[model samples]
Target chain A: MLTIHNLQKIYNGTTVVNLTELTITAGESVGLVGNNGAGKTTLFRMILDLIRPSKGEVLSKGTNVMQSGDWKNYTGSYLDEGFLIDYLTTEEYFKFIGDLHGLSGGDVVERLAPFTDLFNGEILNQRKYIRDYSKGNQKKIGIAAAALSNPELLILDEPFANLDPSSQIRLKNLLKKFREEKQMTMLISSHDLSHVIDVCERIVILEKGQVVQDMQTTENTLQELETYFTV
Target chain B: MLLTLLSHQWKAKLRSSIFQKSLVLNIILGLLILYFGSIFLLLGFGLHKILGNMYPGQDVVGIFNSALLFCFLIDLFFRFLMQELPVLAVQPYLHLPIAKNKLVHYVLVKSVPSIFNLFPLLVFVPFMYTSVMPAYGAAVAIVWVATLLLVTLLNNYLLMYFKRQMSTKPLYTLAFGVAIVGLMLLDYFGVLQLKAISETLFGAVLVNPWLAVVPLVLLAGTYLLNFYYLKAHTYPEELELRKTNTATGGDIAFLNRFGELGKLIELELKLIWRHKRTRSIAMMSVMFLFYGFLFYGKGKFMDGFGTLIFVGIILSGMPMFNYGQFLPGWQSGHFDGLLTQKNISPYQFYTAKYWMMVPVTVLAFILTLPYGFFGYKIILINAATLLYNVGVNVFVIFFFSVYNKERLDLSKGATFNWQGVGASKFVMMLPAMALPILIYLPFGLTGIPYAGIAALGGLGFLGIIFRKQLLQWSANRFVAHKYKLAAGYRQS
Candidate 1:
């Protein structure tokens, strides 16, 4: 569960993220849809406590996210290349993340078996560093690493952007499975309307750092998102 | 088209965000260049007199000729180390309508303006103009100067060609280095007469101006080779293939015993070995471990314990000062992930970093232990500095690390790199180096050097005993600056 109260992020006199109040209960699947400067990442950064907000707070499980470390315990986020240690091998990266989460090497080895479908056989035993991987492959590695610890809360920004069609469908199915099986709370942001509509049970539309729409996913949610962005 | 390409490069340099930020570094580098230029000019103009005074009635021109070849060889070695290929600069133009040959030509020609090319001229041209021109007729002097310049240019392009080749296959670098050393040894022991060869080559140029064609042909040959090499590899895929190979995985499995701390240390070691900046520092620090021999062998610190302790601490703590000054900035690439992870404790992170330095410092101290053969005093002083380094200096490094708000790109080479540097880094070095000396100065000056060494060591031992408290203090400081550091890392 996460709560945002009068959260505002100002950069050079412009409000990058301004949310008056919002909350998401545990096990809720939320997709954040925004345009180019829509403050999607800014809001996520506030939640992750990567950056300090100029006004109000983001609370996780009744505790202010900025003031406490409790949220980090259950949160796993992959926003961009910053989430990866680019110098490490993909396998090493996973193992390092697993070790950080108190998972043993054998446990990590066992866990990576599931990601073989997502990896598409290009990532493992590739003998290449994550830096040298193609952008799409790098994204797969980041996404897989984000899910390494199986945290309660997962956040991904534009996860489907660089992925090919096959990987995108695989990721969607993966998300659906995780949500159904473990009730994992997810906050995914994407420019792609169809992908967001497919995975999220609820969608929140952000425009110019303000939440414009908060509604349950419907049969016509994709059509509604497409119509809104027609211009 | 080349002019347009060059103009873009000029704009890129001027418009770089780093350019404005590094204005002070640029100015300092400019002054350093100016200073080196003046020294070379002085050496050039004074070469005639200095050689005359040394050789006394021998032909100075012959000596200069013999020495010129050695100078060019040394210059070639330096260029091999420092010269970066301009191939990457031409990447943006690859898909453009420009011809591949023209692009390659542009890249090769761009290297002419380098400081390496300009430096030798300052040293060589003056000596030739003032001495050789008047000694020989104008025609021979002109030919000699042209030959020297051509040889310099030849070395530049030849080294570039080899460097490009070696980037893909490093065996060539080793073979060339070995061959050069072998040749130098052969010449040194009087087996091969390089002096005779140099005298004959230049003497022939003076006899017949047309003999300058030798160096001219060599320069042109080297240029064409580089030009063709770049032309063949201009495709993005080919360039990428040449730039990087599949990374061979490394194992630091022994670290698993230490649990999370060991894992962090393993990651840090891998990062250091894998990245250019950190790799260079790591290699250079290991090389500097032998620095104690400079003091011990030369008996430079025989007069007092003060200077001895200074060298001892520096020798032991070299890696800490070099590597620790960056801290979280070195992890800027992945700082967000590191901070967001729940399982990582800041105290443990600090402890892991502090403990990593212990091995390196201990390694350097172990290497320097043979200095005890010189004197018991030297060994005692070094032991004290070693303790000071392990206990006090490492904590200082960690404490000052809290102020590192700049982000560093680990992949860039350390030479002339000013990335992620701030006032905090400069100030950090002061207490790191000064604290040991200040601790040693009191009893050292009062004729109680043993007590000073023991006191410094005792304080360091105390710090070691209470390391948990020290690490907690450092972790608290890190937490205070955590957001500021993250903000800076984001900007970078």
Candidate 2:
């Protein structure tokens, strides 16, 4: 459903992302794995049209993402804290996101019902702003907000980084359920290998902005990814 | 250790993004300092002669001494408003090997060199040289000048202590402000003879320089108070001026009727209400509603359409100008989120801002409608400018909105925070303020000033009628520049 053609992002003569071509099919769950400075977030930013590619363009559903905003209609993305409006309460923020998607207040609560386990009772009815929440709680809020609309395609960067272990497992199961039930296309980037492998059907290992390996997940995929990631 | 800490502060100032990003702003700031510095120096050298002319055949020294009390009082009030507490700079060092006492002293002494404390020296020292040194002997002149400096520092430490107490015991700060205003009012109504008291007190000081000890002792007491306070609460959270607020404001239920546009406006209003900087801008806008009193009744400004038009524009447009200059930057934190959101078109985005600013401009105009009581002419001029503000100037702000790219930290106070201010802000003000007056100038010169006022209002009426096209034009501009803006904000 998304395609990148010769995508490149250059900062001060050094290329941060340089992809000749990459494409994701509909209802495909793909995991992006990279180390620090691998330009994983930069690639996601380009696909989301938050950053203009230095070369070529990103096409969503056969239309250039930059030339038209139609991709945003079916795309929900959370890359960092920048995606979350910190001043709003979690409920207010969810209601806002819900409103954007024409969801009523009750509709918002219904949509957020799936995240109750992931929320761990720390997120809702806290009567605190998102800024006052802990880092892990904030991540949960961001992830849930990204999923609030049940968009056709969802993009998240480092979704498991700040989450607690149990919440991370819950998020993995949540992603699996969304893919199984709604046929949602997800593009998730993570540092945790096993969690991503468990969540995504396919894994793309990125090294310094280039895809060094792309393979379908199997029982041995985790061992292969661990071997490739090892020094 | 103190020197090292001071050096770090100096480096921090030099390397801050706001300071290093814009050389034009730096030059403007430098020229402003020079401009004000020279003006104060000239005023200092000329004060004795001016006072002599006002109170002829009187002891100019005694006159100056009497006014010093009032000057210090006004200075304290201004310091309370403008001065920032220097608590955060010590946070990094708190866990270091440095002693808490040394850090506390650094925080207090660091405030000693601020513009509030040092700028007055430009006037005071020059006055001492021209007036006091010659009138009194060198020893007495030195004592008088030293006493003034002591009081200035006394105000500095006193402000630090009281301002720190502001969060915990706000009543102290309020009581302090009330007492100062009360003293001024009592002096104004002639219930208290502050001038006579001040004259006698400083006269006694000039006769015996030992009387300076009073201010010195008071300064010491406030300093020790600050020192002990800082020593006990060196933790960053306690030293913070504002605690993390419990989320206070709720959704404005009425806003739900407008759909997404309403959501955007509601979000922006909550943004303004929740943040320290934006809230201060709102408060400052309200304060500026009284700004017409400075020029409305004055004969010099009343007769001229030009000056009145300028005043009217400022009266109605201050809030818009103050807040609008930082347009999308206020959302810079979530700008990427905004860009990637569903169905949030550029046109709708600017439309939300347009509708948001229009009512505020109109509300400001209505609030300042009392200025019309000065004259029907004042009403005519204000009504014209109000139209111009809501119609033309709002578009002018939108026209320049795309250039704002810096991220704003909403948590800080707006007083001296220059985080997102750029040269474009100053540039944007030029057309918004000057264009209406320029529109009026030709007709005024042609001896048809009322037509000029009408013409200004006429242009605004036309702008309002064609606002859809103007908004479209603004959105097109935003679309053209969105990529560059997104890139810039991401850097910070």
- Provide the RMSD of all predictions against the true structure, rounded to 1 decimal: 19.4, 19.6
* TM-scores for every candidate against the unseen true structure: 0.67, 0.69
True contacts kept of each: 0.00, 0.00
lDDT of 2 at B323: 95
Give me candidate 1's TM-score against the actual structure: 0.67
Would you give the TM-score of chain B in model 2? Answer: 0.98
- Residues B1-492 of candidate 1: C-alpha lDDT, one tens digit per residue: 678667656655664445656666667667889999999999999999999999999888888887766677788888876776665666534322245667788889888888888888887788888788888977788789889889888888888877776767779767877887777788899998888888888877888889999999988998988887776666443454244545755777899999999989988888887788998888778777777777775555676776788888888889888898998788988999999998789998898898898998998888878878878888888888889988898898888887877778887777667776655666788888887788878887788878999998998899899999999999999999999999888764
- Give the per-residue lDDT of model 1 (tens digit) for A56-115: 999989999755566766877888776666656787777767765788988887877777
* lDDT of every model, 2 decimals: 0.82, 0.87
Fraction of true interface contacts that also occur in model 1: 0.00
lDDT of 2 by residue, A15-82 (tens): 99999888999999999998999899889877876565789899999999766667777888888776
The stretch of ten residues in a row with the least summed lDDT in candidate 1 chain A is A65-74
Top model number, TM-score: 2
Choose the strongest candidate by lDDT: 2
